[model samples]
Target: MTIDALRHSPEQLRARIAAELERARNRSTGLTDAVDGDDLVRQHSPLMSPLVWDYAHIGSQEELWLVRDVGGREPVRPDIDNIYDAFQTKRADRPSLPMLNPDEARVYVSTVRDKALDVLEHTPLEGRRLVEAGFAFGMIVQHEQQHVETMLATHQLRQGPAVLDAPAPPPGAPAAETEVYVPGGMFLMGTDLDPWALDNERPAHAVGVEPYWIDTDPVTNAQYAQFIADGGYADRRWWTPEGWAHRSNAELTAPQFWHDDGTRTRFGHVEPIPPDEPVQHVCWYEADAYARWAGKRLPTEAEWEMAARYDPESGRSLRYPWGDEDPTDEHANLGGRYLQPAPVGAFPKGTSPLGVRGLVGDVWEWTSSDFTPYPGFAMFPYPEYSEVFFGPDYKILRGGSWAADPAAVRATFRNWDYPIRRQIFSGFRCARDV
Candidate 1:
């Protein structure tokens, strides 16, 4: 529930990992039951793998890390390594590959988990490479949760009656003030103290940012509709050269899952757009164009962190907007308790010291900064996790989303994707110069 939980003893860490693994399996199982086995193998989108492949890969990855790497044990099934290797196999070719069917995947994951638990029970939790502070366990849990989010995205892209459901987020009042002015100052920008932080967020450093104004909450459907009505997408000046080219190539008129009938799609169901809810499924290009049309700009990653973490009064950055405590229902709409974004300004209780609302969850807010490493950044447990993707090509997204796990959401957490990616639960708010 807190950072303390992540840094706890071997027994506590084992229990937390077990619970999280179960949670991830429950989500995957629910999606699997919603359709037939054929649906599981059918590629919903070329960007993502088949549902069955994700199911088995989750097990394979667990075995690779917890069972084999940290536990110093032999591989459970070395032959399946190449099949589930994400870097080796392209997504479009996954269905043709020799992947385990749904039943076999389920059984394999169950067996792998059983063996991993036995290893956890006996392994020491201190003074080791991966086992120190239960790093491998936490990493494996987070990895599974990340895949759970990916599988949920596959559900959103698939077409049919709604296979998943959750209650709507709490209503929100119209955003007050419209923008919060963040003072220009040097602020600590990443996590050095949190043991569970990923490699990209390590080696916290001080960053100097100019004073800027940020939206009080995420941009809403009503606001984005104005951009669409104004022919924002038709105009090339508002988009970056690359963004424009991508948009033109894809013929993107609006967010990926939105329909032409004034309704938005979620988990294969269509419903009228909730004017108050934060606009989601928007890519960096659309978000950028919307900001330009509104006479604003996307906040730089440094500026975004300054607003979310700096406390003028306390003179120290807090772990979350509401301080060093785990998120509660009052704080944010998270853990997929709701299937959609909470309306802008919904979680006022979660506002930062400068009164920025909905800073932690509901949607992953796209910042203007490129994905890059901090000063003194070093590869922690592996190179493939974050080091492989650092560059100007990928944009950074701060904050967690509705589907994000509680333990994995932190102020220093970093998420990145290609700027054109819109299928993930992504949205943005506008920022402006002072």
Candidate 2:
């Protein structure tokens, strides 16, 4: 049964929504203060919008979904809706749009949030998709949190001194050298009942996966460094034709945010890479080439899920690697607690039933799967969320990153990006034929 099946009371749902929104607001505010106004509006990279745009966009979406859709109220500022519509404008063009300035963005979001909470107080927890078990509220919280993560990425890409700070993660236990074996079987994948689950993650279905050997932990910086040291980027034989073209055109020598001189940047802070940490900011092309260099392959989304959520003895899947309990610091390094990836295997409590480590909350692991829908998939709330993004044009990334909100991190959560983009905190582990 899904968590929503528990029949949360309207009050309970209100509290949950309030708490999640507060967390998201706090994170966004923190990110906003990390840089000056110029940084907030400047497009740090072509891949993402300026920080101020994200700030206003968060409010715009919340207003669109919660204040207007759920509450049946007129928009607070309908004129700005198209301006903040992510689909209407490209990232490069967003800065030039009439986006609300940082101060106006903050005020707008705060005003909308207060009005949304008032609506939440009167709305039933069940009914339409927007209100059912507080799904729309949950969706808004997730959306805002997602923007916080994106803004954090922008901060990482910004050229400046360190602005964000967090305590370093404690060292991890040594991971077992042997690959974890996922026995071949038909395992149920995706979520049929997770009320907050997106359209792409619906209608759990059986997937027949062959037995395979997967790395016990994510590939580390040291391991990837070895690939680079061996001239992996220069070797075309290891790369797919498209991957080589991307690499050749971009002249990428290392993961994004890394220089040829053996140092990496995190949250705008430059330093030598922690060799044991899981590699971050790697594009699918780079990850695929590294897998080829190591005589392994990026795990298919099925294989990755099978390793992460399937329990052979129970013949059932779990809500997370460590079961249905909500994630904690001991389970994973998430919610921007450390602003950087923990060392691989740091969260032993987060291990999957198959003994795979760091399966969630470190860095998003690239899977060799296109962003496609399941057999019975149907768009809910809106088509723009996931339906439009489905196809071969995007690659899937499973497992949330360190900046990911706990509420947003789930065994079936799906994140997608273009194969050539690398600014996000993305990494990969390898799987091989048993």
The prediction achieving the highest lDDT against the true structure is 2
Summarize candidate 2's per-residue lDDT along 1-434 as a digit string, tens digits: 14854477667767877888888899998899878888888998888899999989999998998899889887899999889999999988998898899899989989999999989888887757667778888888889889888988888878877878889897977775748888878999998778788778898999999989999999999999999999999999999999999999998998887876788777767799889999999999999999999999999999999899998779899999999878888999899998889998788899888899998998999999999989999888789989998999999999999989987889999999999878888999999998
Expressed as tens digits, the lDDT of each residue in 222-269 for candidate 1 is: 889889998999999899998899999999998877788999777777
Q: How close is candidate 2 to the true structure, as a TM-score?
A: 0.98
Question: What's the lDDT for residue 367 in model 2?
Answer: 97
Pairs that collide, model 2:
none
Question: Deviation in angstroms for 363 in model 1?
Answer: 1.2
Clashing pairs in 1: none
Model 2: how far residue 34 lies from native, Å? 2.2
Candidate number of the best TM-score: 2
Q: Each candidate's lDDT (Cα)? A: 0.86, 0.88
RMSD of 2: 1.4
